[model samples]
Target: MARPGRVAVAVPAALLLAACSADPAQPSRQPSDQPAVARSTTPEPSASPSVEPEPQPTPVAPDDLDVSTATGTVRHLAGVVGPREATGPAFARAADWVARAFERQGYDVSRQRVDVPAGESWGVPVSAGRSANVVATPLGFDPTEPHLVVGAHLDTVPQAPGAEDNASGVGVVLAVSAAVSGRRTRLPVVFVAFGAEEPRGPSDDDHHYGSRRYVALLAPAERAAVRGMVSLDRVGVGATVPVGSASDGDPVQRSLLAAARRAGVPAVPDPGQRSSDHWSFVRNGLPGARLGSTPYAGYHSAGDVPAVVERAQLERVGRLLLEWLAPR
Candidate 1:
């Protein structure tokens, strides 16, 4: 991993500061409190079942990816919390960092333990321990209304610096949470950093364990109040936005299209692929959409480090998602 140190983000300092106001309040956390997981609308049939393999995006030069990488967002995050392996100490520490980010945004933060077998990662034998998820909700919202969850997984493969695999996703979620504080939304927004998203067993159930448990544990009332789930996975690289959970012409995809056009983000519709944490929500009848990168060459290797993340791409995806959840 690159030696930990502060680096400059590409945008003008003033612009970055203005986009997310700083908060003086210290973070307040309650780790045991799990946020409500409500039932979402079933994947209602679409007249146009728009599900197809997304075309591969043009390969970006490594130099191009780094030209505008944001230091505070991507670099700082990857450095401070590099390669947080599932259920490992670093993973727990990563959760702390995310909780602090939420508090800095003036939102209350909490943690919920995710069930995983003792001493293992997805059936792969390891000494990794229990994992937990982070949750934060903006204040002064109507509790009666179903809420929208904006989530990203927080775990990485053993000993690997998962910059694009995930740290980028965590940073984008923080950026979005920071940018939209105190704003009203069509549905209340909840920010989560799910643990154990990496495969824990050979079966599909072993993967996306964090979100899967989150949905399974939700009280029926909470489930009933769920409006939707927006999962952000591996979003720090690639220029194109891959919509993983929503099919062509689905309500969630439609909303994303409108938001992307509004935000001027160029995106390619994906086949609502369930390879990421969003699938956890989809199986439980909640509408979901994953915005992520094309593919990273260093995906699960030690080569996946901070320098490879596209700072500008990270900012664009975060901004686009913020627009999608903003009151509309």
Candidate 2:
């Protein structure tokens, strides 16, 4: 994903979907090894030269959502992994927790293990360690269409509870899986809990080891099987939904806009999220986008606890994911 360029003011799709007004007072957070956080948003972008078609109403309505479950999942994920880091006990536990969640959702889960040799972290070299990714593939779906792999990182920064930074995303992935648990779809969708999205230290380049590896192992045919990648990261603090940072012309972005419109969820496509798991898929020529809010005050800090997470925002993101999974 290229750095989000200046957005055009007049696309109806963007304007209609973006419902949140940027609170100047909202704390500003920089991309943390890519937090997948939004840097800007508007209620009405100026205006565009071309018009997009109006989205159709979806049969799926995100009503009576069990946000309590989503909140509970977040609490368990963030709280259980106390001060989690990629190569620690907490992260291992977190990864297992994620695998079980998908298994409970009826998918066959696989834990892909990878070793990182001694390498620089946060600008300093550190000893090598181990980590793994939790992945699950849908059953009984048509094999020809391609797979829609949706993921959220399971690891958090050192010393941070990281409720919004990522547990929020993990929770959404599980909740949405549950929401659509019994349904069938047009294509297979793999839900993943990515390990090592955050660097073992503050090093920017060291992050996203899991996703990059996943992309690498994809046989040319498997890469061809990838429909698109959608990442849910840090979407628990604001009313706005984080649109993925893929090229505006990417099929993933176009479908998401249509999905948001159908769900009637207010959203703003984030431009500054090229640094997360989604970017890994994009580099392979598959359209990818991350959904999240920006400037979480507690981002990469100790204050990012579960108590501050917004349940409604989690529900909104979950609903949107469910909507996207619907058959065209």
Candidate 3:
């Protein structure tokens, strides 16, 4: 997808959904050798944007949330993405876990395997193993109308336990699934655990393999029916820092802020620019936004593990998301 050239790209729907097969995991297609991690002599981005103070929400006492067990579930999910684990198996396990969690909650689930041709940037190939994207949609909903797509990428950068980077995001997705278990909503909700977000070898724009493929594969009607997308990336702990960032002009941004305030989370608008899974949908004219903390010290490092996440933080973020997604 082309970057927003001062304005969003308005490509024809057919052109946007064109088919291509750039599977990176295939050994036959991999360059005879692997390339070193693409280095950028590119200068660090100009002085980071100043963050706006987020609305200070009344702190809900821990007792307010029955989070002991819920937090355990989050930890278990973090363990599933242990550092050093192969990205393929790790993502597959996370996907299966999501499916089983939804099943236990009585929702019918479906899996969509997307095959996207590897583009210019493949960070570092990890066998381009068979990647799969998981989707679970509740039955008994009107299939003709647009649905809310809540998603997260289950994969991580190499060697990072990705506890805060994403396990936090996955944890939130699963937690919401459980929170709404057996409940009814006016709009169908599709929860997805995407794969191949980490850079692959020799492929540019290969960062979002799983999501890119899924979007490309969606039938025109299906793509058009998407109401909006919310991607959760790194919404874990804060450093007791008093800061937030948000773009008040965007409708999706406004909706998220409204949800945070309604749920009483001390969610300050993250003040800096960000790029995550949400970018994929937004580029496709699908309204979407991401939730995460920047300057994550543990990011892309071996030290990032399940222990890095804060349960209280997770619960608060989870509560805010569930409230936004709760049946209206």
Question: What is the TM-score of each predicted model, taking all chains together?
Answer: 0.74, 0.76, 0.70
Q: Kindly report which residue stretches of model 3 are placed more than 4 angstroms away from their true locations once superposed.
A: 1-70, 84-87, 116-125, 201-204, 239-248, 271-274
RMSD of 1: 31.7
lDDT of 2 by residue, 2-28 (tens): 344534445655766664555667676
* Residue range 144-240, candidate 3, lDDT tens digits: 5788888887777666767776777777777777656555444567888887666654433756777777788778888888886777877777732
- Candidate 1, which ten residues in sequence have the lowest lDDT sum? 58-67
RMSD of candidate 3 to true structure, Å: 33.3
Q: Write the number of the candidate with greater TM-score, choosing between 1 and 3.
A: 1
Instruction: Return the clash pairs for model 2, or none.
Output: 9-46, 9-47, 10-47, 10-48, 122-203, 242-292, 244-290
TM-score between candidate 2 and the true structure: 0.76
Task: Please estimate how well model 1 matches the true structure, expressed as its whole-model Cα lDDT.
Answer: 0.73
lDDT value, residue 299 of candidate 3: 76
lDDT values for all models: 0.73, 0.76, 0.65
How does residue 148 of candidate 1 score in lDDT? Answer: 85
RMSD of each: 31.7, 32.0, 33.3
Worst 10 residues of 2 by lDDT: 56-65
lDDT (10s digit) by residue, model 1, range 113-203: 8867643453346653688889898765544468888898888877667888787887777777765565455667888999888875667
In model 2, what is the error at residue 284, expressed in angstroms? Answer: 1.5
